[model samples]
Target: MVTAMASLPHIDNPVKLAVKDVAISYGGRTVLESVTFDVHEHEIFGIIGPANSGKTSFLKTLNRMDIFNPSMTFTGQITFNDRDIRKWRNVYSLRKRIGVVFPLPVGLPLTVYENVALAPRLSGVTGKADLDIIVERCLERAALWDEVKDRLDSLGSLLSGGQQQRLTIARALSQEPELLMLDEFSIAVDPVTTMRIEDVLKKLKKEMTIVLVTNLVQQARRLADRMALFLDGEVVEVGITEDLFAGQVKDQRTKDYLDGRFG
Candidate 1:
């Protein structure tokens, strides 16, 4: 059975991700400073902040995507599924368990079916029948199966902006990740499509943890079980979604941001 938003599990649930004193820098410039939080299993954890607040940088670190940058530096401990990420021998294997979707739709030039099947194929599932089932299941979970079922053979890049974003989500779901991170997923998506994806996320939380980085406070309020508010590279506050918005914040900055006082 799918859990409803109103009855979502409490923040005290077992932690899926534990970030302790995490800090990141590019070259000599600090991006995130001493951030710490816990993401409960099977819950939607929202990260909200203005541009350049290190929201995306933090998300990348969760999956070790920051390794692509030669100048990137990180300090502190990030543990996933009770194991320290820094000590992981296979970063690629770690990433396969943590899926990520970026702000913009980055659809591969391949067909819609291929786009969803690529990851599974890379993981060595080459059976045609198995790939077909995986592709259909992922697309259906992303709320995109019906729209693209007829055009599975069509190029992914040929889809509209909203469709392409959903396609990216389907591709991410294909990995069957233990945790899923979405960075400003609604930016390029239409309002209707955004709501549809949000519904998908609500259903998905029953299966895996979600880290949602969004600038829209209301969006966070609607989907997040709890949230951490970021400002100037710091975690200003973290608490239950309703309690935070109900004016039970720890810092003035948090209340200010929630009240539209400032970014």
Candidate 2:
């Protein structure tokens, strides 16, 4: 059953990520414009919009992933844990604290155990016994342990699409990130697998902040503590999920989208 945001207990958590007047551009064309929002600690913040609405573009900026593209340009400020991202001397260190999962699974051509262990190993976990525990713990959290525990030595790429996605998630979990971002996570996943991952996310929010960028509004409603609706590179509305769906939206465009009038 889906859990509505309105029914969830409210916690006065401190801000984990703050985006202020943030905008993104590529080769002189603006992708997102002047977006501002605060994601509270341990809350699931959902970003929803139609195609080309700049949702993914904005997600990339959270951990400075946009820097990989020379053509990408950013304006305004994005702060993580109250510190400006621009001042972070080691971008890798910043990324270590933030995990990201993309629309499709990109499993490395390595065994499932090796795939999940890679992150912890890079972080200096050298003891064999410690890596074993970390790998099993993360895979369990990803809802994949029961299915893959016996096949830990099997190549990750050989798994089914849904299983590969779960493996990718397990890899991300190995980082034990302060913030976890998922961009269209259900796109390639089966419905059952999606539901299983959703359950994992529900439990995960108790430990870390989450940023979910999805086109599925219902998914946002089920998982978000607060949501922002983006349209045509602009934020149309942002509010408690229930308020946005209660037919009393401040913006008519928001109501239109919610009512299925148009994307």
Candidate 3:
């Protein structure tokens, strides 16, 4: 669905990420099954489910962090730009193209400037002028620049809870990812700030693919272009946001969940 690409204002805008028949297990117990999906360029995709569903586990697979857990095992192909993820020349390079923001504001111990500038510097952008420009641009995009610009030297942890979440988002944006994956990113923030983050995401999706794993059904209904319902390790259904919330979904389980009948 919606396979056209390279539209004006967005070239090289093909499918940025694809997960096909992907499954995962821990200690021989399966967690996900036959998961297949594509995150298109500049679209916001929402993955919604109850707590303990495999939302985070699925996001972890996109970045290949799932391979680190000793008990975890993954099967099937996760491709970026048509290249098999396992075959990616450098995992870090792939990760740089897909940034993640977690539910908690886990900012680094470093100052805000350093946190945002670290990856760009490591990627060979050594010029102070260039780094300064990048840091400012990403922070501004994440809606934290106006607040943090004058306090670039301040530690990120010192910011308020909402600001810290935005700081973490700014740090992810600093990498200039083609796709941004947010895992319940507003869970730890206030409602007002959550709305602010949602607004930022609405703007950001015009330039980057956004995959949001959230439990807030209303948020998904409001912000997503497409929505996927995850249940018991399977993608129960996926369709346009309007279709899913409009009671057109064909599956009983999905309808029940949407109606608050079950998780």
Candidate 4:
């Protein structure tokens, strides 16, 4: 219910996530090799790649989704909060701190309010008044409150494309996650709505660390403080957004890709 700006504590170690010499394989075919990176607190870190370049696979590794793939094998360390992610207090607890928004909106059978409140309720928030406040704050943060305020009782499937996407974002935000992973969030929405969502992300990044995976070069250039280019299952380059686009990357592959010669 508290709509105040999120107060981040001053810690000596500020990085939120770190991947250290990590490698992943499926059916003995390597998909990621020697991937290494650090995601700082409250910053937007963008990942860009062409199709089948392991962008989504790397994201799945962050939340331990690789465990679900029977053919997937992981090596090396993925550290979160200075501790190995595998050693985190619990997988579920780690997931609660990191939320994910996928490319398309998923319709729930419940009404809009229930859809947003379901996770919070599972987390032991049962008070009606508290649920109302959380839902309103989340919707407002996602920039959907104004449009859906009068339709709180409507089924989630009743929303338009843009509205449903925003609703999914609102649902994710209701958990108050410290890190938000957005995988092609704007791909399914209209241009105007995508811009709105981008603006919302800019505001949200003031409080949460945002990891964005998008195929659009422009989107990464516009919103990212830092960026990583992935190709052939490896990180080709990573640096400040302006630096990456300024023809300063050391890797030939990255430079070529940025110059529209290759991907």
Note each model's CA RMSD in angstroms. Answer: 3.2, 2.8, 3.2, 5.6
Answer with 2 or 3, whichever has the higher TM-score.
Answer: 2
Assess candidate 2 and give its TM-score to the true structure: 0.95
> Deviation in angstroms for 132 in model 3?
1.4
Clashes of each: 0, 0, 0, 0
lDDT of 1 by residue, 1-263 (tens): 12333455555579999999999999989988879989999899999999999998898888888889989878999999899998989999999999989899999999999999999999999999999999999999998999999999999999999999999999999999999999999999999999999999999998999999999999999999889998998899988888889888789999999889993
CA displacement after TM-score superposition, residue 160 of candidate 4 (Å)? 1.5
What are the models' TM-scores?
Answer: 0.96, 0.95, 0.92, 0.92
Tell me the whole-model lDDT of each prediction, alpha carbons only: 0.92, 0.90, 0.86, 0.86
lDDT of 1 at 98: 93
lDDT of 2 by residue, 87-172 (tens): 99999999999999989998999999999999999999999999999999999999999999999999999999999999999999
Measured by TM-score, how close is model 4 to the native structure? 0.92
Q: Which ten residues in a row have the lowest lDDT in candidate 3?
A: 1-10
Please list the residue runs of candidate 4 whose C-alpha ends up more than 4 Å from where it truly belongs after superposition: 1-13
Model 2 residue 123 lDDT?
96
